[model samples]
Target: MGIKKQLGPIEIIVNNASVFDKLGLEEVSAQELDRHFAINVKAPFLLAKSMNEQLTTGSAGKIINLNDWRKARPTRLAYGVTKSALTGLTRTLALSLAPNIQVNEIAFGAYCHPQIYPWVDHVRISA
Candidate 1:
């Protein structure tokens, strides 16, 4: 869809949309897993493929993948695997698009638990 845009070209793509469900794997259905992969993995891959031509013309285009500690957790099997694939895609793209585009991934740690607790006296997490 974006490739057909008259914006000339796209220099940067950030794959950041994700769904984080705090449920056990058994409780999560196949459809839910598919939805996660559709957004987190497939969307980015398709976007990158569609923009390959535009990206090749740029000197230093960038594709940044947003990852998180959840990717390493075993509990969220589907989310973790999809995110892991995204990280791998990031690395592969970095090498594949070299000399023209740059691919990078930034992994973030979970901070909401200890920070969002309203009953704990943990140093005014909100402040």
Candidate 2:
């Protein structure tokens, strides 16, 4: 009845869900950072871990970790920091899942996702 039942197993996972609220270093709270990391880093890590476990012998799986170019930027401090951390996580995951499950990252400088990233779509560029 569910997607897993119909599709057999999760072969490809796109860790795409994340929040990017613009916040300065002084504006970001502990809870805000925790929330951002939980969604951006922890969720993707957990999904990859679960995928590694679900994979059968000789079968390959794919994990695409979606990130933004703002990871190094000063704005959106918490989101930036979390995404930076996720890059490290992705690298380690790729090493751990070698030959079977491949983990990769997709960094977007400009993109649109009305539901998840409404701001990106409406952001104005003066340059």
Candidate 3:
């Protein structure tokens, strides 16, 4: 069965996929940066674009992008840059898709598995 037949309609999209590869300034390669952009930024943009019709068909729609609170991370240069770009994309999409779809970003702080992300010390959500 097609997605429409199974799910009815897509009302909410949560973009949570991200890459946090550790790379220093000198270690960051062109391919690495492109990979980060392709997954972290382009994927979400394309998904939203492709689902625009379905999203706007409903009375209300929401697109939420998961982002990191830290603006800069020297340990993961390319990852940080792509995340920053995602923030801009969220803000721009919100204005562009107004009255139909609501685009927002949830910034997380130091939240990751200890083994996967040894750099992250703790996870805290604050108002």
When summed lDDT is taken over every stretch of 10 residues in candidate 3, the lowest stretch is 111-120
lDDT scores of the candidates, listed in order: 0.76, 0.86, 0.86
Query: How well is each residue in 1-127 modelled by candidate 2, as lDDT tens digits?
Result: 9876788778899999997888989889999999998999999999998888877898999999998875765778888889999999999999999989998999987543344464454544454
| TM-score for each model | 0.76, 0.81, 0.82
Q: What lDDT tens digits, residue by residue, belong to model 1 across residues 10-45?
A: 778888898776546786798988987898889988
| Top-TM-score candidate index | 3
Global local distance difference test of model 1? 0.76
lDDT of 2 at 76: 81
| Residue 102 displacement in candidate 3 (angstroms) | 0.7
Give model 2 RMSD, 1 decimal: 5.5
RMSD of each: 3.7, 5.5, 4.6
